[model samples]
Target: MSRVVSRGLSAASGMLGGALAGAIFKQVWKLASGKEEAPQATSEEYGWREVLVAAAVQGAIFGMVKAAIDRSAAQSIHRATGK
Candidate 1:
């Protein structure tokens, strides 16, 4: 209920959400590409198009997860503090 506790909860939620998003992305990429490994933007083996696409997908997933987690945390904090 305190500010410290609320911030701590938000931080923890963000970490958990990021990890979940990464795992989800890996599974999604595997299914979509039929490959075990996702393309890396810095890797020399992958073409520019492949690398860019991978980066875009990864960014989108991370952004969505972060936003969702942040929103949920904010709502929960508001309910707890009535502020």
Candidate 2:
């Protein structure tokens, strides 16, 4: 595969991974908190602990998803090009 094609696939995979992560986080948050909406970090209604926890969880999920997608994309490119 060409470099352009590989880059395109990587970009597409990253976007899809981000979307998947967001959906997963939303569902997990709902299940864990029993609330449909997650607490905002800047909102006064939520305590600092709750806000920090939500931020941490979301950040972790996003990082993991991005890493996984990036690694998968690189492997796919390597396999296709043998380089």
Q: Which ten residues in a row have the lowest lDDT in candidate 1?
A: 1-10
Q: Kindly list the per-residue Cα lDDT of model 2 for residues 1-83, writing each as its tens digit.
A: 57687688777887899899999999989988898878997789999998888889899999998988888877876797798
Candidate 1: residue 31 lDDT (0-100): 88
Task: Supply candidate 2's per-residue lDDT for 52.
Answer: 88
RMSD per model, one decimal:
1.4, 1.6
Per-residue error (Å), model 1, residue 31:
1.3
Best by lDDT: 2
User: Candidate 1, residue 19: CA error in Å?
Assistant: 0.4
The residue pairs in collision within model 2 are none
The TM-score values for the models, in the order shown, are 0.90, 0.88
- How far out, in Å, is residue 68 in model 2? 1.1
